[model samples]
Target chain A: MLAEMIKFEISRLLKRRTLLFWGIVLLIALFTGIIEYLGMGTPKRTVFDAFSFSTSSIMPLLLAPMAGFFTGGALVEDSRSGLLSLIFSKGVSAFEYVTSKAVTSALSQMCFIGITLVVFFVALLPFFPMGSIYIGAQHYSEAFAYNEPVAYCFLIALLFITAAVAFNGIALLTSVWVKNTFVVMAAPTLLYMGLIYVMSMDATKVSLIDPYANLALIDVYIPVSILHMVCYWAVIALITHVLAIAAFSFKKDYM
Target chain B: MNEVLQVKSLTKRVKQKVILQDVNLSVSEGEILGLIGPNGAGKTTLLKIVSGVVRASSGSVWFDKSAGIGIVPEQAALLGDMDALQNLRMLSSIRGKIGTSEIKQTLKRVGLDPDNKKAVRNYSLGMKQRLMLAQAIMEHPKLLLLDEPTNALDPLGIIDLRMLLSELAQAGTGIIIASHLLNEIERMCDRVAIISGGKILRQVNLRSTEQTPIEVTVSTAYDWDILKRWAESVHVELQKLTPNKGLPRGILKTKMAVSQVISELQSAGIAIESISHVGPNLEAVFLEYAQLEGGVYR
Candidate 1:
């Protein structure tokens, strides 16, 4: 049943026009470096620099909003379309249904971000060189000199995926109560921006909670900071999913 | 027949407004029970509770767990993005994976095209209704609940549904149909339960042809008092009709067989002008219990 549900969820997500919208966003992300090279006097000298720049700078902006827009309507559409009663009547418990939806949304966002990063890297290879890459503080750049730049790029992409999962969880939780699709789509973006603003105001207090902040430090910590950020975001995502399940289970009225 | 469903003292309170109150009913295997009521009479609520889509505030509903259940709500609950075959495939998985050929056969049984590729969103209201019926019967559930099942059906479709339901009932599947069409209920149900104000007003046994009361009207030469005494001696209720242009008239009400009633009246020496049998039709019984002043019945 779980496998079937996952298949259904994936198919449902793919069929929506939202997938097309997200596909267009990914295309835009893929061509950003070429567009930048044409506009600026000098391009990033190596593929690692271009990949890191795109993953850290542009991916978060696109990833969170895309996850938010799609997750926002994940559960709401079933209720609005009068399919909830049919689903529940067929013996699919609310918990199972919500869990399947949450997992499917998170996995989809992960794949979307993963694919975009791969495309961005491949597209930049012809234009940028594979050479000794400079990262982190000018003085500390040598401290991490032994690590491969491509590996570090992957680390940053993983961090962004973690942040996407957390955002998707928040979006799924919001969908438990908010039936309006527009509100579901806009909430995560607003929340992400709000988190960023708070982190900027007080780095000490908010950095531990802010997913994007950890992504920004990919060049500094190399491995440890990225792992810590991933764990932090994953825990938050799990909590939001548990809350979503509880809210859905306790709900007596599907309409 | 074994009892297939038992709903006891079921009550539903939605945000301080009571929707169903102390409703108790049952259906046995092979029995087709009709739930007849006016709007807001809690017929749909009862079905929802029985189907497990809505939780009841109080009371219990017990079903024969071995038998699968099927339900068709007033609004057909189908995924609009999916085509007809896909919708069945998704719903059929709940009963443990029904094959495509079987689903196609079920659709054909419900008068739907097996190969139609149109998405459910484009289906007309009647087509959607047929699809809903098709899904409900796809698993061959032992208990089926239908709410206003004929809402979008044409005359032929309605007849087809009636025949399908009869076939299911004959095959020993219990059915509880809630509908406003009393004539359909009269023809399809073995028993009819009239519900009003969240309570079942009465359960009429349509199969008990002998138990139903028959009304007898007579134009007689005897006086009203004489006819009244004869009826009283025969253990039947008698009403004296107003004399029509100086002609004596009276009516007799009894649960006896028609032949017995005729013989009793003939033995009483009452001249039978017209021996007309007025019915205890489901519609009359339904109205008697559904009206505002009808009061409660067990």
Candidate 2:
């Protein structure tokens, strides 16, 4: 059953126009990487900040939400297309149906994250030569020595990807719960924005659940604190999934 | 009669709209129960509830003398990404039905190219309907529920489906179909239940030879009041003309035979321009049961 569910989920995702949308975002990321390479003569703070700021904010804001909506839409597509009734009628339980969709979509997004990581590395490759050339031009041979915070940079990127995918899973819960297209798209954004607003107000208890706070903590190398935040997001995602199932089981509306 | 499906006061209200109200009906083994109603008479909603896609407000459905049930909703419900064969495999895998070979043969029976690797999205509406039929039969279900199985079907497709339903009934598989096509029900159903306003208006058995006498309409410029009274005077059962907005021209319902009454009207120097047998050919029975006032659904 899991295999069948995954097969259908992957096929559904393939139908989505998300690939083209993501392709555009990737071009922007590439353009930023090239611009940072050309401006390598600037101070180290400005150079690092240029790439860091773009990767931290732009990728998460624009690409993260699209991925979330796509992940969520994959699960709810059957209901939207009127196929749920057919499968349910044929003795397939709601539990199996929902489980298949969630697992398949999550797995697909995991694969997508892996591909995005490849693109991330390729975009940053050009900066390596540009930085070395700038050091040589300054007539300091020792400064030309290339040493990158490769492990730290890669680790932070992985962390952001994990949180983004986890947040996408929660967004998917909204899609499964609500039948309306507008609600499915808006629900996750609203939740993320609401959490951001609450965190801006106070940083005591609820700050632990905010994925952005967790992401920021990852960048600062607070591994223990980041783990704590991931746990909270995982718990919230589990709870949201349960609620999604409940809404589906008792849902009176037919898609 | 071996009861295959039993429902008691199945009710559902969506946002207090009250889609289904006290809908009670049953189908026995080896029977074709036709469900006919207006557009919003809760036909689709009722089918969804039975199929387990929608939960009823307060009702229970028992199938095959067991606690479980299987449903085939009105719209084609196969996986759009998969071909017909894959769709059948998924359905059978859920039920743990053995033998994919038998499933393949059933697909052949329905005239679907199961080996054709085209996805369901690429299939035409008629082909998809055939696949739906194939999937429903593959499980050898104890109770089969089909909604609008003939909606997109052409002439041959309709004939093929009617023959298939007849064959399934012969195999002792109880079937309930929700459809608006009264002619198909009249020709194929053993019995029918008419639902209107979320209620079951009447249950009529079509296989029975007994039929209520129809009131014949004689379209002629001559006066037929004397003929109407003459038929009534002999206790033949008749009524005077009343204008019906639905039918346009004036009409009446009576137990008088068309041949005998037409001969009587000819003797009265009435030249009959046209004669039509118009006493509710399943459609009217549905309208009366649903109490459809103006449009498709009241």
Candidate 3:
């Protein structure tokens, strides 16, 4: 039943035209990046430099809001459409319903990020030329000493996936309490942007707790940063998911 | 018959406002129980509690575990983006019984085109009602809960629904219907429960085939005094109808009294114009319970 519910949620999310719209937006951003890189007329660089520039500069801005938009209004939409009553009548437990929604939304965000990464790499393929590997400072050098540029790209994709999952979790939690679609989408994005602002003011200590800040570290020892980001965001996701389950379980009125 | 649903002392209070109070009711297999009430009488809340869509403040609802239940809410609780077939498939899948052919057949049974590809958003109100009915009956549930099921139905749709419900009841599906259509309730329900101020005022057994008092309407060219004297002699209650336009009407407790009045009128050289039995209808019974003063049925 859980698997079927997850499938249903994923199908519902996929049917939203906004998913395709966001995919197009991500492609356009990648296109703009390629055009700008071409205009730079700088010496050719390795694939890792292109991946770093695209992900660090563009991915967060696009993917975070996409994650929020996709997940934020899910519960609210169900309530407004009266589908919540129908679903609950089918004997679905609140825990099962919430977890299925959370997992499905997270996976959908990952898929969106995955598509963006593919678009980034594919768009950069023509621009990749024979040049020195653009490994960053000492930490990046140490991190990628034995790995290739593609490995760095994979690590960057993982970072974006973690950030997407975290943002989706926050959006899901907001949706649980907030009944409006606009508020559901805006609350998490606003919180994420605020955290980014706070981390910018004091990057040293705040970056440890900021998933987006860790996600923006494209030229650093990415494995460790990705690990930290995943752990921090995983905790946030777990907490929000648990709270959402409780709220949904204890709610007496679906209307 | 076996009990399919048992709701015990179900009370629902929302934000300190009492919605339903000590509402106890039950339905046996093959029984149709009509829940009739005025506006804001907690009928929908009770149905929701029984269907598990809303939790009661303090009470228990027990259903036969083996005989699953189906519900059709007041609103069209369906996915607007999906076509009818897709919506039915998704709902059936949740119950772990998904069959495409069965869904199509159900749609056909509900007077919907099985092949229509229009999303539910574009469906008319009547179509939506039919779809809701289709969803409820597709599972062949032992117990069905319907709230205002005939709200958007056309006359033809209503007749079809009435027949369908009657057929389902005969097949042993316990149904709890909450509707304001008193005539529909009178015709289809085996019993009617009148609710007022969040409480059940009375439960009337509509299935009783026992004879009730007959209302007689008589139009004559003779004086009204003649009919009054005849009614007094026959010891039957009689009331004069409006306009006194050559017609005197009265009510009699027995059909025999009606015949006696007609015989007396005939023998009195009165030109009889019309005679008819108005009713011992459910509407009268409903009005009696619905118009009680101060929430107390006198």
RMSD of each: 6.1, 6.1, 4.5
State model 3's lDDT.
0.76
Report the lDDT tens digits of candidate 3 across residue range B82-137: 89998898788877774999999999999999899999999999999999999988
On lDDT, the stronger of 2 and 3 is 3
DockQ of 2: 0.34
> In terms of docking quality, how is candidate 2 classified?
acceptable
Worst 10 residues of 3 chain B by lDDT: B240-249
DockQ of 3: 0.46
Model 2 TM-score, 2 decimals: 0.78
The number of residue pairs in model 1 that clash at the backbone is 0
Clashing pairs in 3: none
lDDT of 2 by residue, A154-234 (tens): 444555556655656676677766667666666666777777787767645344544443244334332334345546555
Q: Indicate the residue-level lDDT of B71 in model 1.
A: 82
DockQ for each candidate? 0.29, 0.34, 0.46
Question: What C-alpha root-mean-square deviation, in Å, does candidate 3 show against the real structure?
Answer: 4.5
Where does the lowest 10-residue lDDT sum fall in candidate 3 chain A?
Answer: A213-222
lDDT of 1 by residue, B1-298 (tens): 7888999999999988999989989999989999998888899889878876678999999886445678888898887888899889877765565799999999999999989999999999999999999988888878999999999999999999999999999998999999999888898999999888788878988877465555444564553556678878878876544455666654566767678767776787766555555544675576456455453422
Clashes of each: 0, 1, 0
Against the true structure, whose TM-score is highest? 3
Q: For each candidate, what TM-score against the reference?
A: 0.81, 0.78, 0.85
